[model samples]
Target: MLIATHSGKFHADDVWAVAVLDILFPGSQLIRTRDAARLAEADFAVDVGGVWDAAAGRFDHHQKGFDGARQNGVVYASAGLVWKEYGGRCVAQLAHECCGQELPPQRAQEIAWAIDSDLVQYLDMADTGSAKNAPGGYGLSAVVSGFNPTWIDEQMAGSVEAAEEFRLNQFRRAMGFIREIIINAVKYRVGALLALDQVRQAERLEGGSVLFLGNAALPWSSVVRNEMPEVLFVVSYSMNENRHMIHTVPVAADSFKARKDLPKAWAGLRGGELAAVTGVEDAIFCHNNVFIAAAVSYEGIMRLARLALAEPDPRGA
Candidate 1:
């Protein structure tokens, strides 16, 4: 199989599309040329062909009247187009390659959807020149653009092929960066799935509003906030220094505003001062913003969690 994209000034969308093809069709020959004859000879053409025939393995998105978008309405670039056709299978392969685990079909679909929402969709939107929801200039597109070699930088080289070499090297660098990101994303997701049972184990603890865990690194937020809504705090013990941590459930993943924060009095306190106010022995510190608190002992943190749960809240009594 041959994976082809436009030869000059590659964008993030085509770079990623070719990268995905490398994963989907291992050992496929890659050709970078704008010649119609060269593009037509390839088994697959992306970003340069000006066609959107999935059946024909052509996945350009710039053609007139080509109105392809995901269900969420972000228009498809070549990357998104290829993702729509091959993301699930490629994600499953990535899970195995990066995480050493097999992804069930349903789980593969979940991961594909997640990567699309979090990463792929934005790449598509950026390539299409759409306005970003967030403040501009800190996305995958900007990072990939940095890989482009400046003309002055290449002009110093004596060889006539320096410009050509510069573009290819820049393309390789971008491809490597994206490949690492894709693998790490899949690996982290698979690791989260593996840790769900541990979180569930903590959930079965019958007690106050806090769930306790022996492992501080456990990903308890999603399992607790989404699955068991009543959990207000999660106390976890860390073996490194025999410390314990208390975490408040945020209203959302990106939001710092907690569903139930630590007591306002305990905010920004530390050492014996924190212990004195919270009435918990060995209390280490509490953040100024009240999102998290630390204690010197598991026993101390558990008591701290219980005490904070009883503290007055703006939302209720």
Candidate 2:
């Protein structure tokens, strides 16, 4: 399979669209050109063919009279156009490759829409001049644009062929970065979906005030803050660190403030000092901010949890 995109320069939209196709169709030949015959012969024409047919694998929004937009009115760039058709497949592919799960068709589509909403639409927005980059030029679109060769670099190439070759290499680098972003996004969302049920069924202790998750790696804060309001502290065994952990539940998803913090006396204490203060022989360290603490054994963490629960809230909530 051959993938043809426009030559000379690249943007996030084109780079992202081509990256998605390259991932789905590995080992495809990639060419950067505006030659009509070359584009006609390619299996996929991205950001150049002046066409917008997904079934035919022609993904471009530069054609005349183009008015493709999402329900929320974000215009379609090559990124959004290709993603609208292939994003679900991309999600399913990544889920299986990265998370080792075959996501249901509906679930895959849902995640695709989520990625579109969270990321693709913004690329489209920037491409169509419907939105501006972040003030500091830190946006992904800006960062991708930065990968283009500067005038001095192009001049140093000394010839059109050398400049084009250098530009192609940069485009591939941008593709590699975008591909990693897609992989990580799919992995995190799939992991979150898989963990929802486990979070819901986590063992409740201390009259439901403490939730014990068997695996500390599981993401529980959003579930605890949103659904399990009664849970103030969570105790889990961290397999990676080989330690038991106690975590204070945050009052909101984005807030750093916890619903109930560990006792102030235990703040910044570690090892023997923490054990002496909390009276848990295997107690480890408590973070200075008191949002989390650790112990060597489950019993030690449980004791710490009980001690924290009995202590009056410093805020007197």
Candidate 3:
């Protein structure tokens, strides 16, 4: 996944965020820009706009007054503006103000918090009546909601053992699909895109064996769900003129499937019922089209199946 950091002007926070992204995804490219044209092609662009407000001596989105007193007028405002303007499809704001420290790990956690916070606002804004109950209009509500302070604390409070187990499970499920389709016995060239540096393993499946049997965590909005046995898959997409398409896949399951056999299973999963059975409850799929800024929840795995089918067979590549 490509990550682009945009700012109307630079700030310490933007520098820190870029450093964190670099540490997390060494292969991912990072770009700094104020011009809308440069950001048009990014797969995922983070707006550090607010950081420039102090520098520009302008009012930030949060209406925080800028004083030219602190080292020559630097502010944090343009990131949001650029995000609002040319962010196009895959855009997320990296609200770094809440996180006090600039350490890599801390910054990464802050990034997660920002993303989750933004997602909540996005969901709220999309829902009807949300604006009426909200303190301000929809736009203001979104900004306020996106500024989550306790997210990192909450996540950190969770059991480390539990979190590791959950992450491992999700990684296994992802590997299952990858092995089955991309690294099948057919020997297709397979590539992987993992953000948040969450992938723990990408092992090759020896046979069609269902070796491991245990519950795993599935990626939801902010937290990962520990559902048993059956896997839940999520597929999110955004299209760009230059990049063509960018997709996010999150999975949770108990075992692995062979590479060659995934096609039939994937096909069968399309539009299937997602209701939980004995071991799993609240099984569902959430598909978000970032290009259109829309999201939908599916009853079953059909959305993933459809996405898989829609994807060109990389074997041909």
151: Cα error in model 3, Å: 33
Better of 1 and 3 by lDDT: 1
Q: Top lDDT: which candidate number? A: 2
Q: lDDT by residue for model 1 over 1-317, one digit each (tens)?
A: 98888876887888888888888888988877889999999989999879999889899998899999888789999889988888888889988887788889888989888988888888888889884524667677887877877777678755647776778878878888888888878877788898899888774333647788889877777778788777788888889868999888886878887878888898899999998897887999999999889998767887888788778898773
In angstroms, how far off is 206's CA in candidate 2? 0.6
Off by over 4 Å in 2: 132-135, 314-316
Give a tens-digit lDDT track for model 3, residues 1-317: 45555432233222323333333345666554445565556544544233333223221233245331212222223232322222221111122222222334443444343432343223222322323224554443233333322446337749755444443343333323322321121111011112212322211111311111111221221222232122222233223211111122223233232121222222212122322211112323222321111113222223333434344544552
Worst 10 residues of 3 by lDDT: 185-194
Instruction: Note the Cα lDDT for every prediction shown.
Output: 0.83, 0.93, 0.30
TM-scores for candidates 1 onward, in order: 0.90, 0.90, 0.20
- What is the lDDT for 57 in model 3? 23
- Give me the displacement of residue 73 in model 1, in angstroms: 2.0
lDDT of 3 at 133: 26
